[model samples]
Every structure is written in structure tokens, then in C-alpha cells.
Target: MTKKTRYGVKFYSVCTTDDYGLNLQIYSGKSDEAEGLSKIQTLVHSLMEPFLDSGHNVFMDNFYNSVDLSGKLLKRKMHTTGTLRQNHKKNPTAITQAKLKKGQHLSKRSKNVYISNWKDKLEVLAVYH
Candidate 1:
């Protein structure tokens, strides 16, 4: 009660303005990893399974964003734009490690993946890869 932090079960949900939840999945400890995908990637895939191959754009934050996942989603006709987790191993080190002054930005691309890193209070990496 003295602290500001509150902890409880975490759930992943896909919702729209019209409906509270179109789909939902509970995080129950460890889940089986799908082939060629990490646990987090699998989680997103499962929740979005019914929505794939229909040219949908997914906007996500760093917690659910990764270079590999972005590329995989592209193949399924789903485009993703999101902030990348700074410590994610799959992030391009050259782009992420580049030093930038406040308000400055650095960007790089490989094949179809484009990564842009911006400096504000901290470096935030955004990828449309």
C-alpha cells in the first residue's frame, strides 16, 4: 500500500473500438515456442491468426516488437510499425549503437527492413522492417 506499484496477472488481448475483445490470450507462465518464432512472436501470431493475410497494419510498442517478427509478419501480408526493444538481440547494432544528439535521428535499411533510431530523452528505435 505504501508503494505505487501494483502487480497482477497479465493478459494479451486484441480489441477494437466497437468490441472490448475480439480475441484474448492469458499469459500462463511458459508457453510452447512455435517453429521459427519466439514465445512473444508466437503469442502475437496466435492472437492475430484470424486476421492474417488480409493486409492489416499492426502498431505495437517495444514490448511486442522485434526485427524478426516484423519480417515474418510482412510475409503474411501484415505490416508492422513499432518501437524496438533496445536490448533485443535481433536489432541491428549498427543502427541502434549509433550515437545521436537530442532531436537527431539515424536510419538504415537492409533488404525490405528499415530501422530508424531517434534521440530524445533517450534513444528510441522504430522499425518498419
Candidate 2:
């Protein structure tokens, strides 16, 4: 008999704001990646609809990065900022020769930057820790 491997696993997470950092909302489920994302979107919409309706800013990680997701949040009038993954390929020009001229310095850097869909450009910033 041949052995089979299970590909899906239950993912759990607690979504909250940067200000408070911890809120009493936890979600867990056993599903594929797409289903997990859909569940998260539904949960976020339900929990954050009021805040979004009142014009609040919502910060998220790149895991939730998508044009559709961004559009949905923007439709609710919420601003967002997050560290986008390099593999996202949202900004092709962001990794040009000019930007990567100093390969060594750039390789070990994780800088605070702003990327916008409107302009599709990156603006690096100096943030105080």
C-alpha cells in the first residue's frame, strides 16, 4: 500500500491593531490557503466594519496582500501600510539596477517604505526606533 500525505493544516491567528497589539479575537480553521484567506477576509470585515466605516487606518502584513483585498478595504475607506514581500511582483520597477546598485548594502536591509497602487512606486523613509 502507498502512503498519502496530508497537505492541509489548521491555521490559527489573532488579529488586532498596532496600538493595542492584543484584542480578544482569535480565528482558526482547517482548509486550503485560499479558504483560509477568505475566512480571514470575512472575519476582518465583520470585526472591523465599524472602524472602517468611521474612517480608520488598518495596517496589515503582506500575507493579506492582493488587489482585491486592497480594493475592498479602500471601499470601506480604510488606509493600509504593510511590508510587501519581494515575490509579490506588484512593483516591477522597484528592483531596478539603480535601486540595487549597492548590492551588498541593499541585501541586508529592511527599510521602511511606502508603496502605492496609484503610482506604483516605492518611497523609502527614515523611521526612528
Candidate 3:
């Protein structure tokens, strides 16, 4: 989702392989949400409820990607590919500590999860499993 400030409603949506809308949740700001999982992770899992265990691929942005979350999704037969925040928790030490040049990148795997950090004008992290 875009972080740019805009005057309008926002919605989190799940789509099919062909880009068909499958399910959607209207964003209502962070209030009175569930207690266990973080709101975004909860929202992602719930949106994906119907499609779990069917080998679906979920693509998301940095706001929705993290190491633990990707592993959990993998266990449910779902694959996730998304941009990761540089300061995200639970990142592999080798990949995170590597010094990559402008055209270089580092990749490491733990179980089924593979995390990559690439440097261009700025450093970028991508996670998938």
C-alpha cells in the first residue's frame, strides 16, 4: 500500500492469479482490533482463509512482510513474496550483515524461507518461501 497521504478511503484486498478480486477488508484505522497477532498479519491470514492449503502465492509490500509471518504462511501451503523493511526483526544474520555494492546482493535461506538484500540506489530486501 502507498504511504503517501491521500484524502480517501483505504481497503486491503486479496486477488486471484488472474487479478480477480477474491475478498476485501475495509481499513477502519487501528482501533479495537484483536489481541494476538498483529493487525496486518491477522488481516492477511483472514483474507487468505479460503485459499489456504491450495498452494497460492501472496505478494505484498514491506508493510506486510516479515520472517515469522512468511514461515507461518509456508506451513499453510502458501508462498509469500514481498519487500522487507531493512530493520525488520528476525532477519538472517549473514544476509543482513553482508556489505553489498551498488550492483550486488546477498541471499540466504532458512528452511523454506529465502531472504535477499540487493543494493541499487538504495538497499532493498525481499523475502519469499
Candidate 4:
């Protein structure tokens, strides 16, 4: 349930949200040469092949969400909802550092996706498509 990376020599494992055992898919961080988004895409494809095009929604955290990945998943008929890192490719720059009050939020949408930023104790960016 654990895999190691070559660059930072990091290790990762998939844990289930429920109280069940850990998820079987063990994904190491991408190799040192792999690009950020490409690495995420590769891992997702490998782990989600059977579920693609099945109209399922995949929820993920910042480590696994990105603009490129969200669009790709949507094309395969799968939807994604999750937090995204601000520096991800094609992710909007306007809200990355924008300061929002307690209940303020910013949102934008594309043909098949929507992105939003909410401010609480800190800024949170969410993407869904």
C-alpha cells in the first residue's frame, strides 16, 4: 500500500475514507523527470481505468487535482471535484493570492467545469467538472 519516489524519495499510500482497510492502489510520487500534471494524469489513468467513462465523480485533494487533470477526466466522462494548487497549469491567477473576507468567494466556469475560491482562515480553491 506504499510506493516510493525517485526525486524526493517520497512514499505514498491510498487510504480509504471509510473505516475499511486502506485502498489497494499505492502510488509513489512521479519520477524525477515527470512533469507535474503529467505525473498526476498517469497515476490517475492507471488507477482509474476501469472507472473512467462510467459517470462517476472522483474527489481528491490538492495533491491530485489540477486544471489539466480535471479536463482530461471530464472528456472521459468522469467528473472531478477537489482542491487545486494555485500554480497548476492553466489555473486562474486572479484568486491565488486574492484576499477574501469571511464569506466571500470567487468563481469561474468553463465549458464543462467550474472553479471557485473561498476564504476562511485561509484561501481554498475548488474545481469541479
- Highest-lDDT candidate: 1
Model 3 per-residue lDDT tens digits across residues 6-66: 7888888898678899999887777554555677778888889998999989998999889
> Of the candidates shown, which would achieve the greatest TM-score relative to the real structure?
1
Residue 113 of candidate 2: its Cα lDDT?
Answer: 35
State in Å the error of residue 129, model 2. 23
Sorting all predicted structures by lDDT, with the top scorer first, yields: 1, 3, 4, 2
**Per-residue lDDT of candidate 2, residues 36-103 (tens digit):** 34755666665565577566666666665433455566666765555444454333343322242222
Cα distance off (Å), candidate 1, residue 11: 1.2
For each candidate in the order shown, give its overall lDDT on alpha carbons: 0.87, 0.46, 0.86, 0.76
Clashes of each: 0, 0, 0, 0
lDDT of 3 at 111: 89
Pairs of residues clashing in candidate 3: none
Greater lDDT among 1 and 4 belongs to 1
Candidate 4 regions off by >4 Å? Answer: 1-23, 27-37
Worst 10 residues of 3 by lDDT: 31-40
> Where does candidate 4 clash, by residue pair?
none
Query: Which stretch of 10 consecutive residues in model 4 shows the poorest summed lDDT?
Result: 7-16
Every candidate's CA RMSD: 3.5, 8.8, 4.9, 6.1
Candidate 2 wrongly placed segments (more than 4 Å): 1-23, 30-37, 89-99, 103-129
